[model samples]
Every structure is written in structure tokens, then in C-alpha cells.
Target chain A: MAQPLPPLSRRRLLRGLLAAAAVTALPSPGGLARAAEPLTRELPGTGEALPRVGLGSWITFNVGDDPVLREECTAVMAAFFAAGGRLIDSSPMYGSSQATIGHALERLEAVDRVYAADKVWTSSPAEGPAQIEASRQAWGVPRFDLLQVHNLLGWEGHLETLQAMKAAGEVRHLGITTSHGRRHEEVERIMRRVPLDCVQLTYNIVDREAESRLLPLARERGIGVIANRPFQRKRLIRRLAGKPLPPWAAEINTTTWAQFILKFIISHPAITCAIPATTRVDHVRENLAAAREPLPDDAMRRRMADHVRGL
Target chain B: MGGGAWWSYRPEDLLMFSPRVYARLFELHNQALWPAQLLALALGGMALVVLLRPGPRGTRLVAMLLAVAWAFVAWAFLWQRYAPIHWGIAYVIPLFGLQALLLVALGSLGGGLRLPGHWSVRRGLALGLFAYALALHPLTALATGRGLSGAEVIGLTPDPLAMATLGLAAAAEPARRAWLLLLIPVLWCLLSWLTLDTLGDRRAWLPLLAVIVALAARLWPRAPSPG
Candidate 1:
């Protein structure tokens, strides 16, 4: 008969075995693979196939004017498109990033392949329409694909205008966003009660709190989701330093850790796409590769979690 | 992290360091390296003078100079990455070779690096310099703050570079002897880097002194000194 064991040790042994099995059976490189024709998932009440990855304009295109900066933004847009990117997220709070994007779109002349997503960064419901209109005017896009109230800025009133814009065919989708782990319950309630097209929030390999609720809610509601701050502001960069990408990661075509982490974030069935903010053209291309392959299954996800956690 | 905090291109970066500072530093050096500074100057001076020595000593000095040269190169090139998060380790002394070598050279000349036959002074004077350098960082930062080159640091604080230089110099043998002669001043300049970048305010770094000392004691346990 097996000797009696303490309960804590038994739990530990089981967790260890489960982790081992998961790592051992990680899918070959084909995991984290995206569709051949730039696969996209449909937004709620909408049939459009959004590209599985977008670009967040937090620190990237936010720097206004500086002609050279505009040129670099254009290159990033071009590189983004080259890598099958479609959705680009921007907001007024980001200091003329939307305006800069408008400048870039005109220069690239490639707005046709883009999804314009901007947010109203104010709290007054009365000014909501004007704010949305300003963003629309700032970007010079005839109709925004999605308009969100950044960080729940306008609460219900901004959402009302976004809803109206959607109904009027002025905007394709009404979405909202929050970050730094705030407003999770609020985001969840919105997903549950209202009709929404997209939701943006921070989700990186380091912060998996969304895995418990928000991501699952998006799937249940059929709302498209976009991940922001997917890098945790370079923490992952330091964590992976001098460490080679796992051989198994090559199965998903990961040449670098950016693709590796992005793949991990987007691999979960709930994550419609991830919008990583990058200033470099090369970085955008690397980020785009996250959309390329089948995500690591539950087991590989655990391994990825373990790897980053230890680092 | 003298990556030195996100300056969106401010003119003050250049203007912040007044010409007076340069003049003052030169004057201070002329009056002679403060005890610690003198110690650093002696080691630095000896290292340079060794280049004029005959044969093997000169060759060794040349090798040491070349080694220090690469350290500076590595500081500027290979390890210049700044991502805010790693600022703790990145700005802490060895984060850059110019800073590290400067400390090491000073440390060797200071009294901390006493060899078996060399004189060893009590630690009081060096400790005082360490405390004074530690206190002056915020004052220096204030001077640089008047003009905004846009360097927005989360905060700045003194780091343990002085203590580290002292500990390392105290632990090496012939090298320790040379370093101890420079220790007081080396310790001061190393702490000076904290003012240059506040050095993480990573209080958790205290344990690092124990780690560095432990590593150095193991690696350079007192070797017999030659005359």
C-alpha cells in the first residue's frame, strides 16, 4: 500500500506532474498559427472580420508634429499593414496621436486596409458627440470603424453617443477601455448588459488577471477584444534577456520573444486580438507575427506562464 | 539610468550643467582630490605613470588601460539599453564600465585597498566622504532641475556605489592595495553617479553589498603580497 502522505505534498505532487505533462506535450510550431488569409473574428452584431492584431497609439504615434516622427509613424503603419495588421487604436488623450495618424494615413494612402479606432477622453455626456466628432475630424476618417470612451471617461452618455454613431452608420462599433487593472467589474458589466463591438484593456504575459473574467465575458458576449500594454512596458524584455526562445516556440514560428509573448496572449480563444504599442517598424512586424499561428494549448500556456513568472 | 529620464528634447540637458560646475570640479582637483579624491587621483595617476615605467610594469599598465578602455566601450554600446524597469541594475555602478572603472581606479588608490605590507587607515574618513556624497545627490539634482530637458525621473536617491567600491577594493590583494589607496575618492565619485542618475532608489540593493563582498572574498581571498 502507498504510504499516507500529507495533503499539501499531495497537492504539490499533482501540480508538478500536471505542469510536466503540459510542457512535454506542447504543440509543435504550428501552434499559435493564424489564418492563411489574415484570419479575423466577427465583432458583436457586426459581420466584419477584424485583423487579429492592432496597434495601440499610447507612446508610439502620440508624439505630434516632428516631421521625422510622422515619417516614422508612416513607416510603422506601412510595416503594420505588410504584416497583416488592420485595427489601429488611438485616443485624444494621447496628445494628437489621432491627428498624427490622420497625417500618416494621408501620406500612406492606405486607409482602405485600416480599422480606425479612437476614443473620447472626456467625462461630460453633453460634450460626447462633439468630442467624438473632433476625434473623427482629427483623424479625417469618414466613419470610424470603432469609437470608444477611453477608461470609461464619459460613462453612459459617451456610450450613448457611440451607440448612436453605430446606429447612424457613423461608426461601425461602440467600444470602451480601461487599464492598469482598474474597472474590471465595470468592464464586465458593460460587456454583459450592453451591446458592444470591442473592448480594450491591458493583458500581458505578466498580468493574467483578465483570464479569470473579462476575456471570458468577451467570448460569451461576442464582443471583439483588443489587448493593450501586452508588453508590461519592457519587463518581459528584461526577463527573457540572454534566454533563447524555446525550440517548441518555433512550432508557432516565433523568431523572437515579442512574437512568443504576443502569441501567448492571443492564443487563448477569448483574446480576439492584441494591440501592442511600438515605435519601431521592426517591432511592429515582430508584434504582428503573434497572429500567425495556433496558440499554445492549455499546457503550453502554463509553461509560458511558468517561464515568465520565474523570470 | 542617466538614460536620464524621458527628455523629449529639452535644451536644458546641455545648459543644466553650468560652466561653473566644470570650473569648480577642476579647482577641486587642483586643491587635490579630497582625501578620497586624492586617493582616486593617486591610483589614476599611478596607473598613468606606470605607462612610463620600463618593460613588464608598463606592459601590465598598458593591458590594464586597454581593459578599462573596453569597459567604457561596453558601457556605451553593449549595455546601454534603458527600459525604466531595469534602471535599478542598469544604473547601479557596473551598469556602465566608465562608472565602474572610475570607481575601481579610485578604490585602488584609496586606503580601503590596503595590501599586506601597505598602511591601513581606520574607516572613519572614508565613511564620512561616503555620507557626504550620499547627501549631496539631491542637491545636485536640484541644480539640474531648473531647465527641463524633459528628464522626468520617478525619483532619485543615493546608491551603494561608494560602499561597493570600498568593499571591492578592501577585498582584492595587490589590486586591493592599489584600490584602497584610491578608495576614499573612488567611493565619492561612485556615489557621484547616484546624483548623475539617483540610482534606482532600489533600497533592496543593500543585500547586494553582501553578495558582492561574498563573491569578492571568495574570488580574491588575500594573496601573498610581493615586495
Candidate 2:
């Protein structure tokens, strides 16, 4: 016969542990910066300045236990940090990606430079806290700067736990995430109801469903917006590869297709960050370079959108 | 980008690793099991000989050899390696283990398999598949502009190993539970096909083609026994 086990839910168990441990500020091991300070946006209400460009570890960082691939990922992270980029987002669902990030940070010794962001992804409410804790252990962080309810799965329970964690200072901010223009209605509803510090959604130039409602709501609510899949996971870049960049793109100082797409996302007033995941060091540098000054104004933004749309 | 409908999700949408990572897995797996790859080929050769000729001792030997291959793949490739990168692989690892146990049971307990007594279309097709898995399949790496290190060797990688097992099962004369041996390998082939297809690799057709040939061989008429 199996035991029923303790009645304590994972959230409560985590809360108890949080109460016992002293919440210390994460150490900054700075001095990797080699570029001018990249453009940054303030996290809604917290006044925390986050680099407009962040590194995403989705398909790019899930490189198993292979030492070579792990080192390659570390090099990408090194380039990202060297360019004055800060926020690095990952999730439990990304399979070994968090561990890879931890490996990179450990190798680079730039944990201080990274604004660690992760997500709670399990549908089981009781499993949410444990997952977040495991992710924290994977990233080797004291606590994540932001923890989001991934794709709105079991958002009710995970959101409540995140709010509790935020109040307890276990996490600095709480938010929800959706990708590929998914579940916008529910995402918008949560933005209205919850005191979210940020919201992450798929907002590349092609997939702009969030523009009409979610982006506006995020701005109105003072919630920082993170634009994910800025290059549609490299599909958009591949699509625009052979096509010549519009001559007007030079007006915004965009030179490549990646810089064009990333600039369009970060230039939005509501978007606090654009996380473009990559496996190459050169690509990481190019992504961070897009965050430099001379961003696209409203007219240029429309022109950029139209140019890609026409292409 | 379709409205988050579960059905709307394509195979590529679920793939969390890149083709480069997938190729690297094989290269590293091949590197770790260096001399053992030669042993894997030897075992495959032994199985091929047994497949072409029908005898109780040889049949049992082939089954045991397949059992070894399945067990090794379950532990080394799927469990130790792939489970970390692709979390869903952990669930399928046990299926490989179960297939190994089934092969062991078939080898020890006997009577489930019925090998053809003489040359037939099925036997020829079986030999073809064995040859493909053991030899031709690995060359796909070189053909696709990848290094020999990423070759899908029989008994080492799942795709070729599954193809070889399906070949062995197809060569056997129809039996009550012999189809059990084909079940997991067949499913694995379909899955491999989906994964490769999702990656947009043309080699996706290789596994799918193996399935079609294996099934056809299974259904092919057995030659008449000696009078």
C-alpha cells in the first residue's frame, strides 16, 4: 500500500522554506561590459531598468549533456553579456536549457550581469512551486527576477502562488506568458485582474495580434511587455534572408534582417524587452546591437512593418 | 500561430531542439561507444546470417543478439543521453526496455517465431533491410554533408536498430505473438519519421520507407516447406 503523504501543498511548503531562509540580494559580478549602455525600459512600478534586448533560451540552449554544445552556449552568453545585454529568460519546459544557462553563467562568472527570469509551467497547482524551485536550482539563482505562468496553464493556482512569492520577496516580479499569439483573451483578462509587473507574448513583426489589445492593456496597466519569438524562432529571418533590406531601414540604423525585426519589437512603447534566442555568438552580438540608440519612430515603425509585410 | 488550438500545433512547434543538436547527439554517442560500434556491426552480421538461414539455434541467437542491442540502446542512447535533452524520451525508454525483455523471452522460451525454411521474397526483403540498417543507413550522414561521426549505426542508434528489428520480425513466418516483436520498433520508426520530418530533413522518408517495406515483407507469401 502507498502512503497518502503530507497534506501540505507545494506552494505552502515553498512558503515555509522561504520564511526560514534569509532572502539576500543576488551578487553582481560585473565588468564584462564592452559596449555602450544599451537602451533599457523600466519595469512597471519597480523602476528596475532592464536592457531592451534579452537572451532567450528556448530551442537554442536545450543542448543536452554534450560538453561541446554546453561550451558553445556559454560563448553565446559571453557575447550577450559583453554587449551590455542583461535579462536572460528560460523555463522548465525548455528541457535542460536552464541547466545550460547555469553552465554558461558558471563558466562566464557573469551571474551578476544576468537578470534571471524563469517560468512555472506545470498544470498541477501543487507542482508549480516545486517546478519553480527546481528551475531556480538549475539556474543557480537565489530567486528569479520574474516568474510567469507559462501559456496560462493552471494560471489561477500558479498566479496566486507567484503573487504570494512576490509579496514574500522570493521573486521580485510576477507575470504570465503566452507565445505564437496564443490565448490573447485570457491573457488580457489576467492583465486586467492581476497586479502583474510584466507580460510576455509573441510579438514579432508578422504576429502582431497582441498589438491591438494586449500591448495597449499592458501599457495602460503599467505592466512591462516582453516580446518573445521576435524573429518567429528564426523563420522570419530565413524568410527575409535573400530579400534586400528596405533602403529606409538605414534611417533606424538597422543593417540586417534580425536587427530590423528586433528593433521593431523593442521600439514599441509598451515593449520592455525583446528576447531573441540564438545558438551563435555572432548572432547574439547582432541581437544586442539592435538595442542601440536611433530606434524607429511611429512612422518608421509602420514603414518597417509594411516593408516586412510586403516582402 | 493558429489560436492556440491543440490540433493547430504542427510537429515543428513541439520540437525543442535544433537539427544541429540532434546531429551532435549521434556524433557524441558514436564517440563514447567507439570500439563497441565494431561489436554492434559484428552482432548485426551474426543476426543477418541467421536471418538468411533458418535453424532453431541461429534463430535463438538472432533473438538474443537483438535483445542485447535493444537493452544497450535503452540504457546508453535513450536513458543516459537523450532523456536529458528531450524530456519526453524518458517515457519511451521503458518501451525499449520492454522490447529487450520480450526479445530475451522469445529467445529463451521459443515457439513464438517461425523462420522460413528456404529463400523467399520475404527473406530477400529481410536481408535488404538488414543490409540497409547495417550499411547503407550510415552513409546517409555523409550524403547529407554531415561527418561519419553522426552516422546511424545499427544497434547504436534507434532508427537503424528499429529498422533492423522490423526486418528480423518480417522475415519470420507468421506466428501468433511474433507481431509483438514488431510493435515497439514500428512505433519507434513512426516517431523517428515524425521527428526527422519535423526537422525538415529529407531522411524522414527513410524510416517511413522502412516501415512500408517491413510490413510488405511481413505480408509476403512464405515459400513452401521441403516435402
Candidate 3:
């Protein structure tokens, strides 16, 4: 009952395939050129290589009508794009964040350069379309690169709507999300039965419960995985503050404790990206820097996790 | 929501805005209300002056002024400013509206005649709270390393206004009526304390302290009203 897919959607799909082919032509993962370049991982469905570090707009970007804070948010976005970051994620539930991101995108004129991801969060199936449209208007984007049902709220109806949107080429990708270690069984069930481009869940140094099941499930399903709460909403970072970075952190090229923790999460083979929200331009750059070359290998990852566990 | 699910949420999880945004809301509110802030300060001063004498007319005047403040804040801050960012505030807005109506009823219907009078510990505590809401609340910005631009004015920002309400309600003629009037302000103070505390702001204590003082003012005896 839906119209045929649009030419723009077809072109984007072709572009993704070409980009994936280009990545395949690049040097081996361990080659010097690849190591020196910024870290990126391919989306399982589209083969689009998204930078492993994405911006999250939770408390960080919900500055409402405060011009000073809006300008500060814009600066953070500008820095994010300059650092080769893409895939800025937000939800309608976060007050004014969608508008804030729209404000920044309009000011920076980097809408075309960034990957816009937002969520549909409402209980009524009837309200889902209106809310998603409102979110797109708030972002000033023609379409969202990805849309998810937040926390599995109204997932049944919203997922059906998102599937139609994807089929109609109204959205590039569709998914579901949960955070703070919530509703995992439902999320796992959705991933098993329904097709999803990505599954976002809490996966930080301390909140590794996702590792036991969700991460492995994502890998098994060939689903792209986005790690949210990479800093456990900054509680982990605050706890690790003033603690020395491990001496061997030099091997993964980590300087600050933020980069050390971030690198540890991204180093996992299944993690497509980690969205760490920030209000500071310096912190955004520092977060992106975590995605750079010489990410910790399997053995180092174990040591890194154990060290933080002991700390 | 069943079982332990409710306990899993931390305070910060429910707080959508940062302290910076919260503080700036007051600053922007103060800026928009401009010279009106001086009028609000003057009303607070008037309430303090009238509380000292405690005549029937004075009691009604205090109630009338407080009613006006509740109406203004309900519209200006809660509805126009806060509800946009916090949909939860929409529910609180009607409570404020109800508070305004209650104060109006107390003032016009002579219910204020029941307000407590005479020099007692209750009266003294009331005076202290009224004076603090009027003069001291704004000065708190300085202690927090912020400028006057972000200062919360009486009747304009909720905290000081709530504190002042508790202060004025201390004199309610019928002790029962005093409790009725103190209900909203006391609840608002507790909610404010939780919000500020979650933001890690030290001033979170001010509302709690005000609540304690206001409670003492109501419950503490007044020298047996002297024969």
C-alpha cells in the first residue's frame, strides 16, 4: 500500500555500497594508513562506515531558549563535525534538545555532513507519526538517518510505522533503544523477530551486563550496535577522576581517563559507535579523540576492564 | 513500576535540565519582568511591614498581595516559561492557579481575619521569614558566585514566593486555616529542595531551612497570648 521508493533513497543506498567498497579497497585494518586515520565501523545492513564516536544530546543539549547555552551547544556541534564525528543522537523526550540540534545544524550549515538520529517516544500509536514529524521539523532535516522506539514504549505500533517509513524511504534506517539497563528482554525479543539496523543499549566500563547477552546477540544477528551511557552518565568518569591512567594506556594512544574508558568500549568488536553526550567543546573533541588509531586489542581490553574493575 | 523498578531511577535521571539551565531560567525570568521586579520587592516589603502590626485590614492586604503574586507566577513563570521545557510543570501550573484562588478567597471573604495576631514566637518567626524572602533571597546569588542578574526576586521566582507564603500564613486566625494556606508553599519548597539538591547546588538547603523555620513559626508557642 506504500508508494515506490524514491530516487534519493536509491541513490543513498548506492552511495553506501560504493563507500563500503572503498573501505574494502583500503589497506588492512592494522596497516599504518588505517591506524593513522580516524576509526570507523561499517553498519551491518547498509555497509555505511559511521565514525565510532557519535554525539549524544541528553542533558547536555537540552538548554531551552537560553541563547548563551544555545551558542555553546552550537560550538560543541561545530567541534564534533570538525573532529570527523557523525551520527548525533537525540530523542523527543529530552526537552528542547531536538530544537537545539536543529539550531546548531542551521548555524554550522553541517546538516549534510552529519548523520541525524532521533527517536519516537510516545505511548499512543496514533501519536507516533505526528511526534516523528515534529522531531524532524525540530532537527530541520528532511529525514532522519535513523529512528528508534525509545525504551520499547509503544514498540509494537511504532515499529510497524517505522518499517513502513523505511519501506517508503522516509527514513534511512529503523531500530529500538533502551538505556540504564532497562527492558532488555523485550529489546532482545524485538531484535530476534523484527529487522533492525542498530540496537542501542547501555554498555560502559561498569555496566557490562549488556556484554553477556545483548552485545553477543547483536553480533550474531549482524545488527549494528550503538553503545549508550559510555560513561555511565558521567558517574564512571567522576569515580575514575584523579586516578592515574594505566602506564600501558600509551599503547592504545589514550591520554585522559575519558579516552581510556571510551577506547575500551569502542575496542569491542561488536560496538558500531558509542554516543557520549557532552556540553563542552573540549570534552567533545576529547571524546572523538578516543576513536583514533591503535585501539586496544582483545588482551588489552581484558586488562583495561580488569583494571577499572579493581579501581 | 511494579516491584523494585521505581527504586532503580536516580534523582538525576528524572531531572531533565542542568543546573546552568535551571539558574538561567531565573535570570531570564527576572530580565523579562524588569522594573516589575522592583514592584514585587516593594510588595514583599509591604507584607513585612504589615505583618508587624497584624490588624484585620493589614491581614487582608497581605493575603491580597500574595494572591496577586501566585497568579502572576502561575502565568509568567510556570505556564509561559517552565511548561515548555518541562511538561510536568503543566500539572503544577493548575496547583498554583488553585493557590491564587485560595489566597483571593481568604482576602476578599474576610477569611484572613482568622490570621494569628499578637507578639508570639510564631509571629517573630513569621517576620523573620517575610524579611528573608524580601531582602535576603536575592543576596543569595552573591554567595553562590552569581551576579544579581540571576537573583530570584520575591513574587517573581517560586522559592522566595513560597517561603514568603509560609511566613504570611503563620498569622492565620484559625490555626487550621494556617495549615490549609501553608500546604502548597510547603510542598513547593520540598520539591524545590529535591530539584536543587539533585543539581548539586548548595542553595538546595535554603528551601528546606525555610520550611523548618516556617514550621517552627506555626507550631512554636506565642507566650500564651498574654492576659
Candidate 4:
């Protein structure tokens, strides 16, 4: 007779279930292949590990009510989860994106696995709560896993509301986001004064303004840094289309230009995760592949930057 | 769709206006150009009356009104504003102007605008299409989630003008001459369908359906001319 099997721990059981789900979520043949065991980073405030690669819904997920396009978006989301992605960031400013995400979630049945991050984007203090409520409804989520003040719009008023919501368990974490390096001083001032769990801003190989101040400050303040525009909205990738990746990219296990650029962002010690939005499944697969082992070291990070700048 | 460096950007990114931004533009256009819209509505009303009771002078006037409307939209919307964001609009402006000039030339040489000699299923369908352009196209915004403020009215916006032109062409006599008039509007419909599809707007199929109905009316066997 076979020896009696040992009882599985709850953590191990959950992992097994997740592994099975990931396998089931794999794309059919002729679709992009899935990545395994995605890399993750710990949130400094809560010490919870989050996948280093996440999806942003700025323009990619704004498909409004077209069944064919929605199906394509569903495929993109399915591929995202299959690669162990969890965080999906959106905002009211990205019109219809939240609604589209809700539609995709309904179709994919992956709501429980999603780490929903949204933003309060209105300028009115009174309107902030209503906007947040609208975003929640659009996303079909009972509560947001992370809520941020988009571009620091009405930051003072919205930050207080986000904090209160977090305390009340309506939001898991409170944060603020900015992009294009706009209002960095004000963002830094807020970061210094407020006890934010996360601060999102644009940081790519070409745009490294965050490295001098925001990244260092986030590190000192124990705030998680979420990097946005990892590909600079496809500008960097487009600029380097004909150029071949340097042999050094192999050290970080990067193949495509997208991977090279994303690895550069996430390799930074300050960045907890980098959210890159794409409408194509192949692109999503390529993006998530950047989250695998052998991220660039400090010297390699510098080399990555220099390589792009030279190109 | 993929070729060269141009394919590097997604089709949606090429759109200068988001749906909200596009709606806001219509709002601002309507607000700033107030009573002008009322005047355009009056022209559309006149055109409908002429369409019902065909006459040479009334037909010429309707064609002139369409030409003026297309020219106005080309200047006011495409050339001045939309071109700033979408560089392709500069090329599109010329096409609108060309369509307007075609209408002007056709209106000046006046036999093609006469309605079909007899009433039939084909004629009724054509009339319905024209009526849809005038009476129903504006209301489509409601179903499309764009609201009444963003509605593209006939004799005011490019879409309804293109749509109404096809409807008018389908109802007119001499299939071969009408086919010449159908060319620009059909092209516009296809272009609009592609752009709207890229934006994921539900109304993307509207132009396509209009094209199909227009083609059916054009090809439908005409009731034998009255003896």
C-alpha cells in the first residue's frame, strides 16, 4: 500500500489552485505562450508581495461596447492573468476604461484575482467621493485594492477622503500618481508630508527624472513606487524599432525592445511594479516576460539607459 | 494594417479626439455657432419639402444647400480645429471641398436631380433613408450614449450630410449619373466606419448599413416609367 500523504498547508493549497488556474488561462494554440512564476516585489507599507508587471488602462482598455474589440480585450486580460499579473490600474480620466475593465472581468471571471487600482480625478472636493463611487461602479468592485489621486488633482481634499476610506476598509491602500514629470516638486512635498502607501509616476529608460528625487524619496519614506509609462507610450520602442538590442540585454533575459525598456524600469530598487498598457495579446505576453528572473543590476541598469540614449 | 514605421502606433492613438472630447467639441461648436444651426435646420426642412415634391428650382436649391453645408463643416470643423490634432484631417478637408464642388457643378447642370418617375418600394426605401438622415440621425446619439448635445444634425455635420447625399442620390433618376454622385458619399461612409470602428463606438455600423441600403435602392428594378 502507498504511504499516507501529508496534509497540505493552506498556503500550499492556494498556490496549487492558482497554478491550476494559470494553466487553464493559457491561450489556445497560435496565440502567445504564457510565462511562468512571475517576479514580485513587496509593498513597503504592508509587506504584501505584488507582481512586478501590471496592466495600465489609459488608452488600451477603453474599448466601448464593440463586441469584437471587447473580445480582443478579454483575450488580453486572460493572457495577463495567465502570466501571474494581478494589478490593473485605471482612472476616470481614461474615459470608459473602467467600464471596459468591468466587462472583461465579467467575461473572464477573474475579478477575485484582480488587484484593482483606480483614481479620483475630479478637481472638486465634494465631487471626489462621487467620482470614486462612479469608478467603483464602473469596475464592478465592492472596494478598490488601491485608490490614488490622479495627477495630484485636488490632492489635499482627495487624499483625506482616500485615507478615511482606507481606515473604513473601503480601500486597501491610499496613494497619489503623476506623469510626464509634471508637478514633481508638489508631489515630493506631498510625499514628504503625507504617509502614502504608494506614489505612481512616469519612469522609463529615456525619462529618468524620477531617479534623482522621487525614487530616492520613496525609498527613504518607505513608500512603494509604481512606475507608469514604462515604454513612454510606445515612443521609445518606436524610436528603437530598427535598432537591435545590445548583447548585454541577454544578461537580464530580455529579448524584445519592450522587455528591455520594462526591465530597466522595474530593475530600479525604488520601483515596486511597472504598469504597461497594450491591446495585443502577443504584446502582453512579451511585456509579462520581462518579469522573469535576472533583472538588471545597477551597472546593467546604467548600461540599458545608455544604450537607448545612444540609439 | 501593418507596414513600415506607421504601424508602430495603434489606430486609436491616431484619433485626435476621444469620444468624450468629440462630444465636447460638438457641444462647443453648437454653443458658439448658435442660430446658424437653426438656419441649417431650416434648410434641411426645405430640402425635405423639395424632396417630396420634385421641381427643377427646388432641386437646385437643395443641392446648393448640401454643397454649402459640406463646405462649412470642412472649414469650421476639419480644417480649423481637427487638423491641429490629427494631421490626416488636412487631407480630408480637401475631399470635403471636392464633394461640395461636385454638388455645385451637378446643381448648375440640372437634369440629374429629378426624382424617379413613379413611386415604388425602391423609391419608398430611398425616401426613408433621406428621412432617417434628417429626422433620425440626430437622435442616434441617444442610443449611442453620446446624448442629444453631440448629435450630428443633417445640413450641419459631415456624417449626416454624407448620409443624406447618398439617400438623395438613391432617389434620383438615371442610375449611371447618380452613381457618379454616390462615389464621394460611399467613400466617406467607408472612411467614417473605419474611424468609428477604431474608436470602438457602437455607431460604427451605421454608415455601413446606410451604404448597403443605398446600394440596394440604386440597384432595385425601377417601376416602369409612366406611359
Per residue, candidate 2 scores C-alpha lDDT tens digits across B1-227 of: 63778887778879989988898889899999898888888888877876777687788788888888899899999988888889899899999999999888875584646687777888788779978999889889986667788888999989999998888888874454568888999999999999999888879999999999988988877678777
Interface RMSD of each: 16.3, 1.4, 3.5, 12.5
- Per-model chain B TM-scores are 0.24, 0.94, 0.94, 0.90
Ranked candidates (DockQ, high to low): 2, 3, 4, 1
Comparison by TM-score, 3 against 4, better one: 3
- In candidate 4, list every pair of residues with a backbone clash: none
**DockQ values of all predictions:** 0.02, 0.60, 0.33, 0.05
lDDT of 2 by residue, A1-311 (tens): 99987899764564444323211111124623323468889998998999999999999999998888887787677667767779999998898999999987766666777899999999899999888899999998888999998899999999899988988999999899998888888898888998899999999888989889998999899999999989887789889999998888888888999999999999999999999999887788788888887999999889888888897
Off by over 4 Å in 3: A1-37, B1-4, B221-223
Q: Rank the candidates by lDDT, best first.
A: 2, 3, 4, 1
Query: How many residue-pair clashes does candidate 3 contain?
Result: 7
What is candidate 4's lDDT per residue for A146-230, written digit by digit as tens? Answer: 9999988889999999999989999999899988777788889999999999999989888888888989999999999999988
What is candidate 2's CA lDDT for residue A252? 83
Better of 1 and 3 by DockQ: 3
Per-residue lDDT of B1-227 in model 3, one digit per residue for the tens?
11127688889888888888888888898888899988888878877888887787888888888888898898999887776677688889888888888888866584454555567777778888889988999989877676899898999988899999988886565776778789999999999999989989889999999999999888876566656
> Which has the higher lDDT value, candidate number 1 or candidate number 3?
3
* Cα lDDT, all candidates: 0.58, 0.85, 0.85, 0.81
For model 4, the docking class works out as incorrect
- Lowest lDDT sum, 10 consecutive residues, model 1 chain B, at B149-158
